[model samples]
Target chain A: MRPDRPTADEMLEAVEEFLRDKVMPAVTGHLNFHARVAANVIASVRREIGQSPYIEADQRERLMQLLGHDGDWETLNRELCEDIRAGKTDLDDPALLEHLRQVAVENLGVDNPKYSAYARLKE
Target chain B: MAGGSIDAALEAATRKYLSATGIADLKRLSAGASQETWSFDAPTADGLQELILRRAPGGVPESRSTAIGQVREARLIQICHSHGVKAPNVRYVLQPEDGLGVGFVMDRVAGETLAPRVLRDDLYADARTKMAGQSGEAAASIHNVPMGELDFLEEITPLQQWQNTWNAYEKYFLEWSPSPVFDYALRWLKERVPARDRVTLVHGDFRNGNIIWGPEGLRTILDWEIAHFGDPMEDLAWICINSWRFGNIDKPVGGFGRREDMFEGYEKVSGIKVDPERVKFWEIFGSLRWGITCRSMAFTHLTGHDRSVERPAIGRRSSECEADLMILLGRN
Candidate 1:
């Protein structure tokens, strides 16, 4: 990382603040909507950067245990999906269900923390 | 039609078809994935007419096989309207000489189309009470529309629908990343694919956002671009999808009422018994379908087909569907 005063996440925070406070207020119609979306994108990126490492690491370990063998995150995920599609993995496996649910909840946390399902599940 | 203003073409077309002197307030309406909606007022000999023009975006013909296209959408609305469904009356389909491209103009029905407002606004409190029941009645009426008249629509069985959606997801997976949750949901759907009890006209996109309502109740159903022949339960299950609930998770039927209320209204209209199991199957299917749609829309952005910011944002919402799917699968 560069020795910058504003780090990546900090820069994103500043951009999000500008978008919400400066740009959105001045815009109208679709532009206002787009500005809101832009702010949200920045927020999502910040959350993903902060949270995804832990989430993906947890998911990787779970997948390793469930599948009994594993590679990296993408490879293991692809293998699990393939097994599911090809009927190699038992559909009613409790471990599999738990893994899927945990991953979904974790992803939703980064994608949209305010999503109702995630909030309800968190509660 | 490309760069030129559509004012002359619209004026000429209305004059020829509706005997209107001219049109005013030709403003673009908001939020359609593959189509554009424009609201205008026409002054005819009879009176001033509020009309809406729904057309393909940029006058380009919809090449997507999933969409039934604007012409067919107009016809579907017309047919449903004739069957006492709360649908808009199609006034005139634009001709080739009209220079307006592929679309149809219809008499605009005044109502709030925004789902958030319909769900939360004080004015729509009464409407919310009646919406699910009315939605059921509307679905029944739509289903009751003679299938013989809708021969033009594509008939997709439950398995076929699943295959098509899965194929779409697979394409996305190949180009992007595999979603294990989606795969799991698809497998679950395949394992419990509902039988085609009876084939009927399925409003493939029947959800909260596609409906327009007023304080009294449902004024109109909009966006028939994906009308097809499928299991009637698809419509019932579709509206019950958790995503459509818009945070009113307890009120399953479009965030306003119960599934029982909706089923009751449907049964009252069509005299057909509601099958909860079948609806449940389709509800799961609906989540997967929506997830795939979210990913597909995001791919449009990722691939630079349409770089709208909203597209990638929606792509992230695939996780929302995954979360909903996990709940629906009883695994949460």
Candidate 2:
């Protein structure tokens, strides 16, 4: 990778700007609503591109430690859910609660950083 | 054009039922992905009359799980109106020959259905004070609609509803990504499933958004699409859900009034005691349901079935619901 020009994030920013500035002004009615939604999707993509790797790694570390398991993220999570459902895991385990909270907060960071719930948790 | 391309068919149809000499002021007010709602007028011998046409346009079937069909919806409204529920009177049910897919025309009641306006706008200042109490009063009335009349509605008990929902959500999180919080919530809810205190018609989606109101107060409970038989507290609790509070989080009853007032209103109307514990259980259940719903909306966006911006944006709101659950469960 030659450290490319007009990087993906930059391109995403450009596209978001174009939609908000140029295209959004001309539309009205339902299309206008969809256009705003489209802009939001682009913004979400920008956040995901920026934040997903770290969030995934953070969650994976938490899952590995809490579940006492070392494998892919999805597999470990599957085990956690199955164990909880089958009564094999204790939901009240303090470590488990802390892990779930942190991972959920991290997800909110990516998914909707603006949510008031996220703000309350940050405080 | 007030009278759009469908005017000829509408004109003929309005004449048969409304005794209209002319039909005009027909405009497609909204064309949703699944349905279209039109506002129109029939110039009857009496005078210019405003009525609404709510129809599921042809092609993809406009239906949902066990919801009453549009024809049956009209009948339900008629039944409610006749039973003294404040609902728009159903004027005519569409026939196949009417050229509308399957819908009914009803008298358009005067009120704002938009939530933000009803909550924040100056016009509803008095109505705001009355909403929580009136909401409880209205729910009592809706619950009293005779069981015989609602044979068409689905009967889903709260226990059954929560169990099925938990199983589905469990399977989804297992396959997709797991949340120990959801697991803990599930186990907690299972351990605390309240014995059915009362069974009546539950307005499965009762909330501020479903209400049409004015300065006087609530005119009708709209969107009876998911009406079912269940613990009546399910409806009572649903209105208290934080998401429905629309940022007015302090007020437990639809962002307008307190739980005490809601209970007071309900008890006065139905003479049935309101159980706080049962209501609390349903409130938690409502939060979990909304969290899952937010995920499903995101799933649709991710899967590209409906690429609307709103869906994924709504999906991100799952955290808000989760946070609310934490508060409800007193985990904080």
Residue-pair clashes per prediction, in order, are 0, 1
Please give the lDDT score at residue A26 for candidate 1: 100
DockQ, computed on Cα atoms, for candidate 1: 0.81
Q: Residue B54: error of model 2 in Å? A: 1.5
Q: Least accurate stretch of 10 residues (summed lDDT) in model 2 chain B?
A: B57-66
Q: Write the per-residue lDDT of candidate 1 for residues B248-319, one digit (tens) a residue.
A: 988999889999999999999999999899999999889888888888888888888888999999988988
Model 2 per-residue lDDT tens digits across residues A1-123:
236888898888898888889888988877777777778778878888888888878878988997777998778777777777778877667777667666567766776666656665554
Off by over 4 Å in 2: B1-3, B59-63, B167-174, B298-307
Docking class of 2: acceptable
Per-residue error at B49 for model 1, in Å? Answer: 0.5
- Clash pairs, candidate 2, are B2-B26
Model 1 misses residue B121 by how many Å? 1.2
Return the TM-score for each candidate structure. Answer: 0.97, 0.91
Model 2 lDDT, full chain set: 0.78
- In angstroms and one decimal each, the interface RMSD of every candidate reads 1.1, 2.4
Q: Score the docking of each candidate (DockQ).
A: 0.81, 0.48
Q: What is the C-alpha lDDT of each candidate?
A: 0.88, 0.78
